[model samples]
Target: MTTGVERLFDELGHFNRFQACLYFAAIFQAISCGIHYLASVFLVETPTFLCDGPSNITHVLYKNHSSSSLEEIWTHYKPGDGPVVVQTSKGDQWELSPCSKALRLNVINFQYDFFGNKTMESCGSFLYDHSEVEQSIVTDWDLVCEKEWLAKLTQPTFMLGVLIGALVFGDAADRIGRRPILMATSLCQFIFGVTAAFTENYYLFVVMRFLLAMVSSGYLVVVFVYVTEFTGIKVRTWTSMHVHAAFAVGIMVVALVGYLVRVWWIYQIILTLSTSPFLLYCWKFPETPFYLMAKGQYKEAQELLDTMAYFNSLPSTLKVSQLKDENDRALLKDTKKHLETEKRLSILDMFGSLKMAGRSATCWAIWFIGSLGYYVFSLGSVNLGGNQYINLFLAGAVEIPSYLIGCFAMDRVGRKKTCAPALLLAGVACILIIVLPQDNDLLAIFLSMTGKFAIAIAFGLIYLYTCELYPTIIRSLAVGSGSMMCRVGSVVAPFCVYLADIWIYLPQLIVGILAFIIGILTMLLPETLGEPLTSTLEEAEALGSKPYTKNAAVDRLEMKQSIKA
Candidate 1:
């Protein structure tokens, strides 16, 4: 018998204007999230700077020499007479003194004062070049020298908020319907994001940013679920992946915004305000009919289906009676009972069977590996030897083709075939960077972009693959638990960039090995292409054990009913 959801999908029609608008609305949130999550990459950039070298010289130069001559004079004589070179812990060499002699101001004129005491002193303040960026967190707060770690910690701190948000919000999204959570999070993201721009202190900025990240993370999860719930099985994968594509578009947009706006605060304000329209527009979209049916709100479900039908320019043929007619009423009651029965299913239950245990563990590992690779490639852009803005933009742009390729390949070759090789390719690309000469920067960058593309393909495939692996009862738990691990990977990504100080290739090597190992493990998973979605734990375990034809799941359900009888 057709489920109420099936009937609703049939009546409402697929790929209609109503669903299209909803997808666009969801994409708006995706774009905002992409910008917000990575905004720190540009806002806190460390530009070329040196100690405010001898203000006395600057004073005299301004009073005597023309402004045009100042640059020429400063450039000529700034190098130390005998440079005090120091090697960093990472074995890189740097000069201790920016200038050897301090220039002096005579009564009415400036002089280079060559005979002035030649001594090196620790820098008290810095002067940044304003040619590129007007102001960054690095410049505003002087996060150089001993405070450099503060700048490096910013991404991780926001990621920590994401970690906390995933734990709390994923559950909240499940408990409350997806729509309310989305609305609340949209408002919170706007408020906290705007507040972050005006924060006077670094700590306060971190706090506001944390809250913003938390809400933004919730927005991601809720929107993903909300969009998935409304879409039919035929168009579901594309609809969901399109949100991720929107995220890539957001990254490019942020790169453009950052390129144009030189000041950190202004860039932030632009991103924050971009979310304002979502606050009002979100209300126009209705709750998913599935959630309404799950909560036993049959009238609301019918009303929503009817509205969808009308908006789709189809007849309002769906009715409440058609949903709970005698047969489906019992089925609906059984579904409610089934949901209640699965409520007690714990994380331990995910490992109840051997095949399930292996599947869960392998998928979890792949999630961690994929997430680690994705963020490491993305966040590592600032460190790449090129125009940071251009590098960041390319990092995002490279993923677009991967998403497109994934959408095409998964349907033809199946999830395992596509994902396993994608991981291998990503791993090989990252490892290849390790052998390339550092002087061959173009090759390194090309390899890095290739790795990102491969990882993006794997990342998209894993979401679909994971969804197919678990039964409906434990689906949320399985995906949520896996996402928690993804957050852990994100939290660790910043440290990978930091480790570049020790060995530039260390992070890549680690991620590469993990990817290759996980790729092998991914192949162990059963191919789920064209198989019916598993509705029960038993069916999930039995999936790859036999020839899973169209009615196999139904046959199992009938067998269970007969045994009970």
Candidate 2:
């Protein structure tokens, strides 16, 4: 049956100017999340570097060529093909070994070692190719060679913070309200993001990045639930999917900004500053009526509904007397219920029964696999043998059509069919890469992009499908738990990419097998295509096996009787 708030939504007109304003306002948060999530690709990129030569070589060159350019003088010691023959200021050509310096011998008589062994020693410092990225954490903190593990740890650490944020903010929103969490997270994202840019210490930078990611995840979860509650069923799928489309746009923006601003700190500043407009949500946004009604705050729910009706230019069928009557009845019912049961709803409640447990497990597995494949392809895209910026931009660009296709498929074919096939297809695409010729960079990129395309579809579908699968009371908690699992997959994604060193095809092979298995598991989930958003646990548990009717006639009859009374 439709809840009181949902019935009011039907009368007030779904997808009106009020809902439109809120939907667009929430898009900025999604964009900010996209930028922050993938900004590390450029922020920590490893540039082409080599061991700097010995100090004696530098001193000798400086003494001989007093006014010579650094590039001209360093050419004698830098790596190159054969020995470089340089014409000195005296108009004499001298042969210089690129990798070695002769002791107690003339510079002209130095011979280059081309074949087997040379006396190689540990580098005191390193030289980097700064054509692409002028500076990054790798260059600034020397997170290369022996210290490379620290560079790899940055992303997983950020994801860990995101995981914790999902748990904290998810439960808090359910208990307190979505509005406060949403506002607070938005403000904190800005604060931590900008603060991360200014920290000179690498560990301090990582700490700030972790905090920023935490708030970003919280903001994303609350905004999704808040918008989902306000939207009607007819347009919910597209609106939710569009939020991710906005996310893809943010990824593309990162590529653009990363290309234009090669300095890492400056890029961070710009990305965080762009999201400052979203802080206005505190002043403009309203608390969702579904949450109010679920909490038995009928008067507050009715007032919000009246405001919605006024903004949408519709007649308000609810009256103060009707709200008071319902409130009184609800108070008495709650008084009796509280005496009977003291248990509260939580993420654990989703697994309270065997059937619900089975469904929740399937949802969790799907989330895990989806996140793993999505991020594995995302982080590996930059290394796919082309311009990193262009490749990253294409990675985000391909997702737009994927989300559109997912929206169409889920709307027409149902959520199960859409997500399952997409996962299977992504698996097939990734696994096929194992057989490609080693030198075929173009074909390898094509298969990788194909995997990204299919996984993007599945990734987008899971958010909308999970929202529809759970009831309103525990909806944010369920999504948050699912997202927490998603972060677990993301936390492991960097290691998955690192697996390429063990075996060339290892990463894709792993991703493929996992996706294939989860694709089959996804079929066990209930189809939530056209169902009303269930308001209670009993209604949610009956989703797949039971057939529900909106019963417009009965709802109108009840509204008339309540108005008359």
Candidate 3:
């Protein structure tokens, strides 16, 4: 059952200097993606602000005082007596209201209003407390007050682009070549990302960001498939999971950069420019031999295999004759015929039978919950009562261990056990936040971080599990469809955070309930721990009807040896 390309990988050695280089190159892409995807967290952050008052009041108040002294004069017109003290477990903390301004009836006395009715009105303009954020979309466009909804709208718009890109580019990579799509998307990501920083208006900025997100999603999808195709089964899981770790590193990098560079547009430019160096070396990148062999270009596949073998210090005896036997040719013909017949099959076709429908639905739901929980935790971390930069850093940092632990658990235990427990733990962590007092910011932060850590595990597990549940014929379609659901979850994440405005605990409550429900529902899924990947619908449907004695470790070793023989 081993493909000729996979056998070529065995001859080249599964893990080698050449493969290491390719792995690092792909890791760099994932890192860039994490930076770009989460950069919006700082870009649109809402800084503390208060009403600027009417022009008459401002002119009269500042007529004799300089702009530097306006802070002294401005205190007389604030709504509160002073900052209100809220008792916390650590100590008492002062909180200020930023939505209203006081109107003075007479500027001369500035005191008698205590006896008369004090007038208060909504802010016509605003003054921001720029101690933390020097500049942001929220400050530049005044996205507070009534305009706050516009700020929350930005992330969902970007995720919408991701949804569309998965549909379009997933298929395009199949029709054209993975290398062309990867290169094209990389170029487009740079152009669109940089252009977004210099936009004249908010609407233009949103449009540019949408285009950037679209290309970014395409690049990630194609690069992942390209890397997987090149890797032998022995090392594929390690390489794939580490790509996500690289993504976490990117998230940490953005947090560090965001802390250092407080200006939003400059920060945007820096993140976009980080990927520019990849363009210089991309020309040397080779197409996956799997793609070449699948297209019947055995000569090119053989030559690439020889180059890889030489670089890996293996013998260069691999040739087109070795790559294509009568059996392989017949198999290729049958595969080609099957592909042609199923070319028009949609995601809905995945539900052709009862067992297929049940498995597909579970996979899709898990995908949705994973994405929803991941983004909700990430975007909501800034709102936790601590240093926003440190909070974001921890959010990214926790994912590293989550990926490591998730990978280990999947290999040692089973995918079902790993995924279900993680989801349940995340649900419990998030739901517990609702019972804590509002002033208990420290405990709230701890629970949220725990939730983030657990959800990261579940999110990572879904990627590997979904691939194993579907047949190779519609594998890409299954992942793409699941990804669409994931993107839908992401698109809804910001709004979930926005729900905090109505009730402070509303977002956490919703996310927790969904995670808990899905955790239970995931038990219905078949465990694919040691199962071989199915190539047809019948084989896929029969995956978990009976248990197998083989374990993943032994199965992997056997597959590698079979390829060598």
Q: Could you say which candidate leads in TM-score?
A: 3
lDDT of 1 by residue, 214-299 (tens): 98888887788788677765677778777788888778878889998989999999988865888878877688776686688888
Model 1 regions lying over 4 Å from their true place: 58-121, 325-344, 535-539, 548-565
Better of 1 and 2 by TM-score: 1
Question: Candidate 2, clashing residue pairs?
Answer: none
Rank the candidate models, highest TM-score first: 3, 1, 2
Model 2 lDDT per residue over 151-218, tens place: 88888888888788877887799899988898888889899999999999889999999998888888
Q: Give lDDT for model 1.
A: 0.75
lDDT of each candidate versus the true structure: 0.75, 0.74, 0.75
Give the TM-score of each candidate.
0.85, 0.80, 0.86
- Lowest lDDT 10-residue stretch of candidate 1: 556-565
Global lDDT for candidate 3?
0.75
RMSD of each candidate relative to the true structure:
6.7, 6.4, 6.7
Candidates arranged by lDDT, highest first: 3, 1, 2
